[model samples]
Target: MSNAKSYIQTVALRDVKCYAFHGYYPEEQLTGIYFLVDVEVTFVHTGDTENLNHTVNYEVLNTILLEEMANSQKMLETVVRRILDRVLDTYSFLQTGKVGIRKLSPAMPGEVGHSFVELSYVAPK
Candidate 1:
């Protein structure tokens, strides 16, 4: 067997559906929209992986997303940035991460699947 100094692990919360009134257009604000949020974070692994403290909790991520989404904004970029900031702030052990928000059936002329924005985080050296 080979000895290793440390391991890196990534935890993700995917396809989280949320309904919020976030849009630049007035009509979109009135009608509201469905969004799918995906969050993932990479961190240095600890020996006590079984312990909740040693790893990122999915519930915490969900809570952050919901809380941020509750506050309506004209742009998804703002929401995504807020989510990423919260995640990084919540866990000091986090190394890198990404937060993505997708607006389903966006209010546009042509048939569009979704409009998406993603923000990433990297811990300072």
Candidate 2:
């Protein structure tokens, strides 16, 4: 599909931390850092006012992000993919989504700013 035809929606959570094994270094597993996530969803709208069912629910998206954050993985990319997949699987209204995950205070000693990975996916028609 063409980009012009897509409808988009965004949800973001800033500065959330969960302890988990998310790094290559041994110390990383022992001590995890804060992670940030931002999600954007795109879908085709029928433009019917009564069709709330056809739209994505922001609350559900938030819950999914929270659940994914609580469950730690080895890579932020994996986490981002999982969150995107979870949303797509649960909500059919999303035709596409972009997910961004940031790892604050990475394992690098002098890394002053945050490190992050982002991924985008489009649902198959």
Error of 2 at 86 (Å): 0.4
Best candidate (score: TM-score): 1
How far residue 12's Cα lies from its native spot in candidate 1, in Å, is 0.5
Q: Tens digit of lDDT per residue, candidate 2, span 1-125?
A: 56554445543444455545577676776787777778778776755546658677777888888888777677788888998899889876666787887777766679557887989887776
Candidate 1 structure, TM-score to reference: 0.94
TM-score of candidate 2 to 2 decimals:
0.77
Q: Which ten residues in a row have the lowest lDDT in candidate 2?
A: 6-15
TM-score of every candidate:
0.94, 0.77
Candidate 1, residues 63-122, lDDT tens digits: the string is 999999999998889999999999988998899999999999986799999999999888
Distance (Å) between predicted and true CA of 23, model 1?
Answer: 0.3
lDDT for model 1 comes to: 0.92
